[model samples]
Target: MACGPEGDFARSCVPSITTSGHRVTLLTDDGVRIEAAHTPRIPGPEGPYAPSRAPFPAPSADLAVVLAHGFSGSLERPALRRTAAALSQHADVITFSFRGHGGSGGRSTVGDREIHDLTAAVRWARSLGHRTIATVGFSMGGSVVLRQAALHGRRAAVAGPGEHGERTDAWPDAVVAVSAPARWYYRGTAPMRRLHWVVTRPTGRLVSRLGLRTRIHPEEWAAIPLSPTEAVPLIAPTPLLLVHGDRDPYFPVDHPRMLWAAADPATAELWLEPGFGHAENAAGPELLDRIGRWIARRARRTD
Candidate 1:
């Protein structure tokens, strides 16, 4: 098993770190193809460490972490790669590009249909024989994680109907959302206002395509889908961590506060870091390692 330099598989484990990760193409329920990379964890000579908190049990050896990038970001992005490198120290890492971001098919629905993309990634992680899986999302990807968790919970809650058969096999074990917006269509901040223009205006869309290399769908949202605040309550019983920078330029502190309020305090943990920016950019090596340990601790829990 080969691995990257910063990856745990590199040191004291494998002799030569040549060919490491494999590519996985997941077809979402909506028929969109998502490109993903699966980097399996390589155990070191030291073995797994016990959790700092006793509440969480020791995680399984087959634990996996799925990384979801923000808008205009992909698996190849430097920020995402840095995050993956840090997380790779604790567990196996899986990174993917949401639709319209990288090599994935279909235009970005911003946060609406992107749930399919996340679901597909989680499902793919499970298919690889990983008993425990954790999802970590940044920015737009963060909203997608919340919605995906809620969608799975909603399905499980309403599994009696004809179309809504039981989908217990589809849900992830843990979730982390960084710099996610609690409400939709928020134009409070200047950055958000500019982002809205880029997403809603024709000239901005053209610039997004040519300059950012991201394709946004022309169709408008029919109705406000379940907002992140609305979705948080449904994610109860599943471990959730909401991380936000107090200095985020896009969404203010209120966004994370709203999400924290909506989520069940018993199962949710919120981290409001000072002087941090937004998403992957703000997540430094120490922060990423801390996040990795947080997820690893929960992933180990059997109850």
Candidate 2:
């Protein structure tokens, strides 16, 4: 269902979440969750998303951080943990494996279906009353974050500096994309030609074929799906921080460089990490501090 002028989405339209927290929850008429998690890590040693959470960042901050994992990746990646730790200072953090990835249910839809899951997740966070939300995604997850920000993240309507589409109604205050692939998969890009089979194609087919919730759902890019370069226009004027490694194996280093070039410049920002390659396990302390402070402008600087 489309978001109404009132922004109240119907509950029947919302997707279900496999692992939320200690308790199982109900849905609303808007198809969104009114409350996601009361605590960061759920009770007991059996917590699935808990152990992956940061100890000091306390997942109860005012702002809600939604961290997304990349292809075949889980919520346990070191980068997500590090990012979550840094984010803990200002908001309650929410990190989940996408539908088909980790302990979550459903199949990966590449960008097509994943966007819905992300939308639902964002709506769930909004219901928590955090008032502000931000996202950080790795690799493909970076694409997810950018889409959500362009479609619904905070800075969707920055207006004049760049060429953001007017259709944007939802958004995060700020967006961080770590090693984002500006060129999408499936339709045809250097990454797809090189990385799709191991990274995308097979996974997409598996998601659709298995009907199981662990695969990434396939996205038909040639259709209406937004390409990475196209999304930059929507993020215009909204703060965009992109991190790409110079030595990334999957895609060329020029990918981010081209992305930065294609971007309108007056608003978006890009950071190409020289030594870090691809979706890294750890971001240096300097990068960590930069991310932490960057998230602070919109979230809360509680930490």
Candidate 3:
């Protein structure tokens, strides 16, 4: 019992829990193939708790939320499945495997090239005719969402073409980044140090491939991409929510604080949870429900 692919499969085998969804294939701008899954929202219970006011509401036809999982995670991960299930209460949810995770093609460049993965997912969401869209990311994925939002912001909208050719209205209406690091090359924490070893050493890469089912690219960044703190400033106008747990082992509260300080107060909100741990695993139903409500409100306003 560890929570690897097999563990996820075993859990899904239980008669009570069903983790089925529509599977998809996506092509990144660089021509990498990404595996994805889409789950329509589950309607809330009727009666006393109205759908509109319920913690989990009926799905909105106009809104869809793209979920970005942490490193070593895929759409099949139980934690990610739980996250997607919770968000599906309000809007349709699309979860995808990043470049080198699960069945996706190409090797992971950690967080650098993962932006394209997210971009492709968002574009797919748009193509489905969703009038509003949001992105919620955890851990390494948290940084990707921030960078993606900034890179596609109105100010930098024309910086480059999207997965296809069009670049207009390709960004998200709201963003939620949980347990994201503020800067690059952070090895202050033990977990991050172990993660660096996994990404930096050949033996570590082999271990990741065999043990964690993740394939890591064995090259250094050609140039440093924008950090989360650096990207936060450009997300203005669009709503941003930063959620970090005080008890997280990979990153301390200072990381979220840095992102908050760099963001525009008019549109950015930060939540520092007390007992929460890290990423999708630590995000419980209550927290996820709250996030869903926030996205519903923010996306409605943006629309």
Candidate 4:
């Protein structure tokens, strides 16, 4: 259901308009259909909207931030919307549902093949005429964004055509990973152990589907994809930011520290926030604002 005056009016009068942004369908490399939105920043303190293609960036907008939600989170989630709202203050924002989440197709591969989803979103942002792009990911998404940036790199030789024939530049000018795990198969914390069960067991997968609305793929990772620590070293020349709450329950500060140690000091920055919790839900407006400013500054500098 739509909330607030604008969303309610749009829902009642214009049934097709549910969100405060333009709805888009992104096709990943593996042919999964990813649901997405383009939220153009407006003046004052309010949510964003891009009613038509002609007024995408408005006059002030130049950069785009692609937000990747965590394991169970979706583009439609309230927390994710708030994150978009906060980031849209500085740039246009693109938020998308990973496979098996929200309205997207296919099953979630946790963090493995989800890189394709992030890559598709990045390419969509680039196609929207934003020469500069930044990616911000939370939890599982954080790991995916790190791997995506490493795989594509900023200096990718070809602007190759994607599955849909759209020109693809899967790399971003800057990246921010919040509450991401440094290495895979980490079952150190209580939450991590529960998460492992959710992905590895049949009953837990059923609970995830029925209770959380997040569909999990039952098969194990055929091949271990690149870990976040391994990916960090490859992200130099493109600015990277790793943010982890000191009180984060899932993965401790060691995760971010491991990633930071792997990254080039000149290009990578780590923020161990005080009293902050995990991912999108724990990120308040003030923290999001700071993140938006940080990315905006870094993107401009790198450009």
Cα misplacement distance, residue 8 of candidate 1 (Å): 33
My TM-score estimates for the predictions, one after another, are 0.86, 0.68, 0.86, 0.87
What candidate 1 gets wrong by more than 4 Å, as runs, is 1-18, 48-61, 154-168
Better of 1 and 2 by TM-score: 1
lDDT of 1 by residue, 1-303 (tens): 222343221111122122445665566767687787765555557856532232212334478898989999988788998898889888888888989988888998899888878877776676656788888999999998887777675344455322233244557778899999999999999999999999999999999889888999989987777889988998877889999998999999999999999999988999999899999977999899899899989866732
Kindly list the per-residue Cα lDDT of model 2 for residues 230-283, writing each as its tens digit: 777777656677788776766666777766877767766788777876663546
| TM-score-better candidate, 1 vs 4 | 4
Model 3 lDDT per residue over 1-303, tens place: 112232222111111112444555676767787887777766667423232433222333478999999999998889998899889888889899998899888999989999989988887777666779999999999999999998876555655653334354568999999999999999999999999999999999999999989999999999898899989998888899999999999999999999999999999999999999999999999999999999999877988
Error of 2 at 122 (Å): 1.6
C-alpha displacement of 219 in model 1, angstroms?
Answer: 0.6
Query: Model 4, residue 5: what's the lDDT?
Result: 39
lDDT comparison, 2 vs 4, better candidate = 4
Which tens-of-lDDT digit does each residue in 37-115 have in candidate 4? 8887654556454444452334433789999999999998999999998898888898999999998889999999898
What are the lDDT scores of the predictions, listed in order? 0.79, 0.58, 0.83, 0.83
lDDT of 3 at 88: 84
Model 2: residues >4 Å from true position, as ranges? 1-61, 76-79, 153-169, 186-194, 199-224, 280-285, 298-303
- In terms of lDDT, the poorest run of 10 residues in model 4 is 7-16
RMSD of 4: 6.8
**lDDT, candidate 2, residue 25?**
28
